[model samples]
Target: MTWDLLLSGGDADIAISGGRIAAIGPGLPRDAREIADVSGCLVTPGLIDLHTHVGPGYWGIDPDPIAWCSGVTTWVDAGSAGAYTVAGLRRVAETAAVRVHALLNISAVGLAGRTGESRDLANCDVALAIDAVQANRDLFHGIKVRIDAETVGANGVEPLRRGLEAAQACGVPVMVHIGTAPPSLDEVLDLLRPGDLMTHCASGIAAPLGPSVRAAAERGVLLDLGHGSGGFAFDVLERQLDAGLLPTTVSTDLHARSLHGPVFDLPTTMAKLLAVGVPLDGVVEAVTTHPARALGLSCGLAVGAPADIAVFDVRKEPFTVVDAHRQTRVSPIRLVNRATYVAGRLLPPRLPAPPAPWIPLTGAQRSALDHRTRAIRDLLTTPLVGVDGLAEQFPRRSK
Candidate 1:
């Protein structure tokens, strides 16, 4: 059968039909309606970000503009919605071009504000969270709870316990955000189950390097590099690497606050792993197969799998990357995306909306954003070509 699309001249040619991979080999039949030449590019399964904020709330940011350029096809909104507001997030998932999944917040209020969703114990209703997960199994893959001092003031691990209860009831994992001490990091680590995820594992603030952290890792708890504004630190990651504990998944906790810097996108976050001595293949797996496995989502670039793919121009050169602490390191290679496809369809280009009023921007960043906006306006307003460039479909006959 003639394929719907064919990606040729890459590491391996891939033919797509009916939103699934028809075939993948050295040379595919050129019988497709459309073909994209991806010469010298690395073709792989679409990257899945295990942690992010892309629902309607205080932290949400449109994902399309970033996805098209970054080769991330799946975005997991990490606790941006809860039982009361999941419907709104569902609308976002339905309308977005990329795949949008969510981890339901343990707090019924969700992230309607910057923090303190679980401050009031009443909001951490296990019954409500369980119902939300049960009702929206199509959208929610797990539960999320921020167990930091500010987020769970005086409540400590109570919110987490309630979250765990809901997660167990739904048979889904819980992804907990760790931050400053009130309950302390050990108390939070003790509660996570085998498949449960600890985002911001390499946090500078939470510095999870104690015996409790190691014991948790041994017991099958997964560590996630949720590189948000203050989540990742090169020193912490290096120490973890020295101790033989590496992140199971590499994800950008990309939101309004961290999007502009620190955690630009998943690709950049992956580069941070590479900077700290992680193998390139391992890094790729962290963003693709590993995260997919964590959430029980589909992944991989094989026949019969969904035709969710990404092509990147792998540049083998010295590239400097930074972590949350503004710590810089040089990477040996960089993956520049050339194309992104989801369900056998190419993702169209999308411009990002301006940052929210509350988001703080540096002077240089503001200036660059203004420059880009002006450039786009200039390009759109300008005529495509002079009159001579136009061809008349209907010539003035018998004039």
Candidate 2:
């Protein structure tokens, strides 16, 4: 049978038809309707951002399709929605061009802080989370708990314990946000089962899992690099990586604040990992198969699965990748998104636009927020060029 699309490179030829891969081999059918000659590109399963806050940023009505544009065919909204807000997320998920899923926040208010964070320990209502999970069983894959010291406050492990309880009851995995206080990383890891996910695996200044993190990985608990600017630490990551404690999945803990710098999208994250010695296949697995497995979604590019593909330029170019903590590495090799296809439909290229309302600071304003208001004045002066000059945009202060 003729395929709808064929992407060949690296001894892999993925033939797609009816939204699933019909064949993966060297020879191609000559009568295919469309052909993408991705010879110079790295042909891999469409990327998946297993964690993100793309929803609630654009209007709480639609998920930002940046992932789709960046060769991410599917994404799992990490914990942008809790019981109170999941309904809206469901709406957004439906409208998204990419296949979207969720690890519903255990907090009833969901990600309510910037939009809002449900600080009330009372808001960690397991019943509500379970109810939401059941209601959106197709979209809501599991549960999410932000076990940060600031987010959890004095509630300690009580919220985490409840989140685990809900996850257990639902027979689904839990994706926990680590790097917080109250319950140490060990305590949080101890609470997780084999299939559960740990976002921000290398986060804050100090993260959980080094030797212990390796043990957890060996035991089947998945570590994810949900690098959200401040959520990643190079030294800590290096220690973990050197200890053979690598992440099973790679994700951008992307959101309004961390989208521009430090987190340039999934491809940049993959490039940074490659620069750090992660093999291309390993990196691809982390972003593709491993993430899909974590999210319990199909990504095999096999027959019946979605016909999603991400082509990247694995070229040797002078590239500087940064993490949340201003750690920069200048490397000559980088991976860049060439194109993305969803169900055999190709996505177009997009140029970066002015900072959206959700992100009030331009790249320069972020660097100058602590200095003078000169950057803001510059933005006013140059409305045409806009604030893209601020390569280090910071979070806007609370009004």
Error of 2 at 207 (Å): 2.8
Residues 33-109, model 2: lDDT tens digits:
87767777777778888987755634122334475457888878888888888777877778767788888888888
Q: Provide the overall lDDT of each model, using Cα atoms, as 2-decimal numbers.
A: 0.93, 0.76
RMSD of 1: 1.4
Flag clash pairs in model 1: none
Superposition TM-score, candidate 2 onto the true structure: 0.85
The TM-score between candidate 1 and the true structure equals: 0.97
TM-score of each: 0.97, 0.85
Highest-lDDT candidate: 1
Deviating ranges (above 4 Å) for candidate 1: 385-392
